[model samples]
Target chain A: MVLDGIAKTALLGVEMGMTLVLVTVGLTLIFGMMDVINFAHGSLYMLGAYFGLTVVSVTGNWWAALLIAPLLVGLLGGLIEYFSIRPLYGRNPLYHILLTFGFAIMLHGLVTEIWGGQVQNISTPALLDGSVDLVLFSYPLFRLFLLGVSIAVTAALWLAIRQSDFGIVMRASAHDSEMVNALGTDVKRVFTAVFVLGSVLAGLAGVLLGTSQAVDPGMAASIIIQAFAIVVIGGLGSYRGAVVGAFIVGMLNAFGPTFAPQFTDALLYLLMAAVLLVKPAGLFGNPEAT
Target chain B: MSVKDIVGRHFSAHAETDVLSGRVRLGLFVAGVVAVLFAPVAQMIHPFWMDLVTHMFIFALFALSLDFVFGYAGLLSFGHAAMFGAGGYAAALLIQNVTSSALLVLPAAVIIGAIVAAIIGWLSVSARGIYFAMLTLAFAQLFYTIAFNDIPAMLLGVDAVTNGDNGLVGITSLTLFGMDTGSLMSYYYLALVILAGMLALVTRLANSPFGRVLQAIRENEDRVAFIGYNVDRYKIVAFTISGAMAGLAGGLWVPFNSTATTSMLHWTTSGELIVMTLLGGMGTLWGPIAGAFLVVFLEDSLSAIGNWEIYLGIVYIVIVIFAPRGLAGIFQTVRSNPHPKVLLSRVRSALVTYREKVFS
Candidate 1:
């Protein structure tokens, strides 16, 4: 029985971790490329979910919605980058922060205007609808699928970011965009691409999350706060740090209720606080950057 | 020259004009206070406006507290509502279970607020810039979650407190110096007096040597630290002071609303306070009051329209982009100019140019 409980908890933790990883990776990437913290990332994630729901309702195909929603959100992200964020580059970080915050409020307002202020649910596809039986316990096939997809995506992204020629330019621009521009690379285009990619990942996470939970406007605020914590704990701009931080936060969320239910919510923040106290730059972040 | 040097030069050039305008502003402020004080007796204004103004004063105080840390100390806290909520909850609990005295509940709330701020500041002060802001945000969300969720009695072996999401209610009315505090007029006057006192105190603190150090830290932390001042200690103190003031605002808020909820501690509340500070102008004590009035008034007026959030968002974007110094800066410019046409023409030309670019 104890072993069964542990397995269940571990599976739940992995599922939660996957959701967090999806959200945090985009946030970290955006911060890494452009020193701007995208406060509206959560809203973008919600938009993705809402867009996916709309597509599914219209076409009656979950797969089509998954592909289309991310693309649509990514295009919207590119537009936002051009119109709002582009002008604020090289200014104080505060401008981007406030601008994104305003964008978030606007997005939330848009979401409410279109969908109405009600909790929304997306039906899981028939293929991944039911739980699969295990020796000791059964787990949701959808959750397992999510875990697999997250792992595959993370792996593919890791390879693409670390190995590709484009990855080299990305890394170099992150270090010194001015130098990269001097070197004949179109740094502004690179930034827009990174921002769009980050938005795409956020949209993907939103769709995945929508399948499992009730979608609401407030979801963005709650999820973004946790994602921010994960980014900070993992170290801003560090991909590996995001993965590690997500897992830590995910497991804590899964098991904390059993151990210290009263303080479970506070535990992640306390951990973040302790990390800030000991290593302000975060575990995987560069000390000099902080 | 550095940006600071340029700003310093601009301020020096306007020093003579500033003194004259500053007096005018002060006189206007004093007149406004006297008007509010006698507003109850005048009986011309509706009770609704009285309530709105009272609430505005509380939020104004809250925004000023934020400005102390954000504007002066250069620390942008994304979770300021934690301190505000801490004060509100503390005061609410005290009023419900302990005393109805304003003297006791208010001070306790302020002290509790300071303690909470100190703890949060201790944890967050190690990081600089956006990291610090994120840390504060994380901590605030943690508090909000705890307030929102119900903990099982079996887990803590105690009854669930905070009442989960429903929030605490039935806070008894405050009594100050044997006055009937239940009346709207009395409550409004009391809040006005407290706000006035706090405004004076904060203004004095801003002009003091300690406040100057905080401003210095805001401009250049490394330079301030290099000069042998403990920058972290200064930041923590400023944070604590800001928290205490926010707490006082919260304490007043609970009684004014006659309820305290988990939403008070929510991140959106913190966001609203930031908007208020930014709209009025950061780094200015009186500007936050203007901001608070603008936000509350707009919220009150526009809620009937049902699309207020869109308007608020657009306003924020426009202000951040074009008027980063905010409404206060515009007032300053208007004060310095001999004619309003210069400002109007500049704005008109800019708008025309922007329209051409967008259309083209």
Candidate 2:
């Protein structure tokens, strides 16, 4: 019976890990390439959930909303980059922090103003509503779907980055925007694209998370802190680090409740600190920016 | 002369005029003290205003600590509320379990706060700039979790320690040197004394060699390091001191609110302090205090109508664009400007700078 319970816990950990993988990937991507910090990433995630919920609620088609919500969020992200973020580049990094922070507050205020400050819920579509019966226990099918999607997306992302022309330009720009610009690349477009892509990924996390959990205004603030912890542990801007870090964080967060629920957040931080103590640059990160 | 040459020549001509800055500084100091002394009188007219003043002082304490980091040391901590919450929790727990003497408990809270700050600051100093900010934030969240679990009354039925989500209650008021801090007047005075004391200490530090070293580090960290100063050690010291001060404010907060809740440690709390410090004019001893008043007042006034956050967002944007030096900056500039004082011209410039930096 104990063995069965342990197995179930492990499964649950893996499921939670998948959710983290989605969130941290985008976070790692943006922080790695742009040096943008992007405090509003979680808000974008929250927006995705809200957007997905709204569309699905209106049309009663969760799948369609899942596909469309992130695209809409991408456009919003593009606009934010153009209007607010683009001007602040090459200035004091604190300006970026403050600006992004302002953007988060603005987004939260607007979200609350329109949606009200109450917790909102959306049902998983019929295809993934039921649970999958395992030897030990039953698990939600939707969670498994999320797990599969995250893995698939991660693989696709890896491929695109490895092979695509845009990805090569992205890598070049990430190395040095000034150099890339001098080489005749439209650095502005690349930055905007990367911003939108990062936001859309956050939006994707939001949609999936909303299916698993209730959506609320403060959700962005809480989730972002954890996402940040994950990225830091994974090594800022390291995609592989983010992937590995996400699973570790997810598993720890899931199991922390059992060991000591209150210290769940602390446990994540402790783990990060421990990793950083050993490898300050993160597991996958190069010590030097070069 | 060109603008640069003209400005440079005027600056050289007015080298002696900078001495008059001392007079403006003294005047501002007296004005500030007078305002604090008279501020509680507004409470007699309306108790809420007095309570507001008390809160403002608490925030001033918080913002000033932030200035030590962001203003002096060039470290932008996004998780300073951890210290604040730690102090609050310490005072609250002490009140609940041990002695209720405000003197013993508050100082104990500050000491404990300093210890926590030292540990977190030590770990975080390895990184710089945004990385440092993220590390501080992560450490704060970790600290928050520890408070929730390790401390009683925080969570997990540890009511004896933290009192959990319901928060520590029945916290006895300050009996400082045997005086009842329960009285609003007494509490206000206590807060005032502490705030003024902290401000004085900060001013001393800012003017002292340590403060100069900090500013030097801020201006050119690499050079300071090359000069053989363990730049990380200095950063850690500044971080630790700022954390302790943040804790002191937090400790006072327990008695002020009569409870210390987990909410105090949230990132928003840290964010608010950052806003206050920036709005007042970072690096200036008085800027944070001024910022605390302005921000707290604005928040209180604006939250009633909604769109408060948006307004604040706009204010932050505007400050970054126009008044990067903050309210105290305007006064400092005018007092230092070597231009000949003409009829209405000096007065108009002062007013513009003041409004541009402060009220705007």
Candidate number of the best lDDT: 1
Where model 2 places Cα greater than 4 Å from the true spot, the runs are A134-136, A260-262, A287-290, B1-24, B33-37, B150-159, B321-323, B327-360
Q: Among all windows of ten consecutive residues in candidate 1 chain A, which has the lowest summed lDDT? A: A281-290
Candidate 1 structure quality by residue, lDDT tens digits, B1-360: 999999999778655433124664576487576757665654566777777777887898899899889988989999899989989988888888888799998998899889989989988887889988888987887878777774433357666556678888888778898665887777877887887788778777876778889988989999999999999999999999999998999898998888889999999999999899998889877777788889998888987977677788889888886778788877877777748698888688767754543332
Q: Which candidate has the top score in DockQ?
A: 1
What TM-score number comes out for model 2? 0.89
User: Once model 1 is optimally superposed onto the true structure by TM-score, how far is the C-alpha of residue B142 displaced, in angstroms?
Assistant: 3.4
lDDT of each: 0.84, 0.80
What docking grade does candidate 2 earn?
A: acceptable
TM-score of chain A of 2: 0.95
Task: Specify the poorest-scoring 10-residue window by lDDT in model 1 chain B.
Answer: B15-24
- Every model's DockQ, to 2 decimals? 0.46, 0.33
lDDT of 2: 0.80
Residue A150's lDDT in candidate 1: 90
